[model samples]
Target: MARIKPQALLQQSKKKKGPTRISVTTIILCNLVVVLIVFFLFSTYRHWSQRSRFQTDNQFSASEDGNAFMDAKKADVPGYAVLNTSKGFVTVELFKESSPEVVDEFIDLCQKGHFKGVLFNRVIKHYVIQAGTAQGLGATEDWTLRGKHYNQLDMSLNLKHEAFMLGTSKGKRNDKGFELFITTAPIPNLNEQLIVFGQVVKGEEVVQEIEEVDTDENYRPKSSIGIINVSLRQKI
Candidate 1:
């Protein structure tokens, strides 16, 4: 048997081993891909969970002790509402950026046919036009899609109550949601007191017509001026 040199054996071992297959860059890229996938899944899950929770039937009501459940969720996208009234068609663009939870509650009610056939009960000439009430007045018996009532925004956004600006009814200061109103003139005093959730993007004339209608002593329309239907669609 012939003795092999140590150097020769080392060279033969190196030849058998071959070259490195994976580089550091490849490992790093793979890790990055995995991280991105995980993040995407997490975000998707959170979105669906929020949607489900918002659509649930667990009505949030204030206790007799005065502890109310507050809804605080940021808006995800802008929503559009089309009000088909006996007068004319009015379009509104919801301010999801400023009032997300309010917009969500409004859209949910619209989807559930809560606004259909509801009377534009109150109309103040040169001021505002109010609606979304089952009972003509500021009654608490109306139930929204969210619950018997809807959540009030915390009024964090300093949005002005300008012409065409949409605001929830100030029934007891944040205890009303099924009722809403739109201003026909700039009312700066309403700032920080109401949630300006939307604005009229089109059909300002329609809003004016509604506001100009003849009303009784209680601001109710003398004739039947009601909403035929109210629908909401996501902004494309």
Candidate 2:
């Protein structure tokens, strides 16, 4: 039998040792990548959970139905509008400073009884109750106002959709529109979508009642809920 030389033994050892180092490094890198992936997943889940919690807490607070009255808050409110509906009265404090033209147009419409027979056609649970459109909830109306651009109507007001806030947005044409919506909860999702021209300074409970009313699958009230009329109060 031939005896193996020392150099050959050393070369064989080198091959085995070289592969071991490479394998060890690859395993370490793979494990590190897995750790990073898990950490990222955990962080994303935590962020989502926190946001959901915040949304729930804020919604609860907004729905508490706190003191609803035309008090000091309405002192410098510029104006107010009382909407007489089938359910009850909903008084809104107009945001004339932020949205002048839209506010004025709304006031004009209210005083002229434009919404006299319009129904509260749409009501989304925990969302908004929409009205003020001549063609009911779906069809687009040709309500021409002073300004044609969206900014003049305060469509860029970017007001957070809080409970009782009255807002309007365009239909398919996509500009400052006449259809108005009364929100029943704080909706952050609608932040930059609609123009909030006023907020309910009074009759919050009335809004709650309207929102709690039964509706069809299409969110239309099972029972007729019409806007008897809207009265504008320049001095709140």
Candidate 3:
């Protein structure tokens, strides 16, 4: 056998070094790839986390407002009434001092859940709904028995039924509880007759929709505008 030369051994050593250099380069590239993947995953997770936090904050704000309104009602302080109707929610600030009798009657009825499922009987388009008539042609007929006592109250207080009047009167001297009406047009005839107590603060579109409903021969709504619930809310 021929003996190997020193230069030939050196050449073999150079060939082995080539593969070792390639292996080291491959290891470095793999480490760089792993670092990039980790960075991308971390960035995506952070984005998702921030978005979730934002949604949670918005929901919390809405819930807080609702809770505050409920708290105000429980206190019996001068608060607004939130009327949930089929069309939309309407908010009206009750004038307790200006119309004490009417406000007291409305609060009492609300506490007893009398206005629930009631209907907006008479709706004149662009005018108002002449409700609390106990016509028995609309949604609920629970309050129909109270029709006789609708206008049975005395008129010595000089309560006038103007625009947005929350009075219970048949014509002029019959102001009592369990009756309310909102006006769109100028009805000066009710200036010194009905008791103006509250004005609508929200959901005027719901009022507009009520006014646009089909009416009967007596100008009453063909179908009743149902009052889902009437709860007191605080003005925030």
TM-score of each: 0.54, 0.53, 0.52
lDDT of each: 0.70, 0.70, 0.66
Cand. 2 Cα-lDDT: 0.70
For candidate 1, report its TM-score: 0.54
Give the number of colliding residue pairs in candidate 3.
6
Query: Model 2 off-target regions past 4 Å?
Result: 1-78, 134-160, 171-177
Residue by residue across 1-236, what tens digits does model 2's lDDT show?
99999999999988774433457889999999999999999999999999999999888776653423434444434488888988888888889879877787776666566788788777665567888543423432211111122113343345455567888864442122367788776665555557778889889998888878787655668998878888877565
Tens-place lDDT per residue, model 1, 122-213, is 77664567786534233322322111111243234453555898888544432234777787776545564356788899889999988788
Candidate 3 residue 196 C-alpha distance from true site, Å: 1.2
Find the number of clashing residue pairs for candidate 1: 0
Model 3 scores a C-alpha lDDT of 0.66
Worst 10 residues of 3 by lDDT: 142-151
Taking the tens digit of each residue's C-alpha lDDT, what string does model 3 give over 111-170?
788878877776655345755655322333322322222324343444434334344544
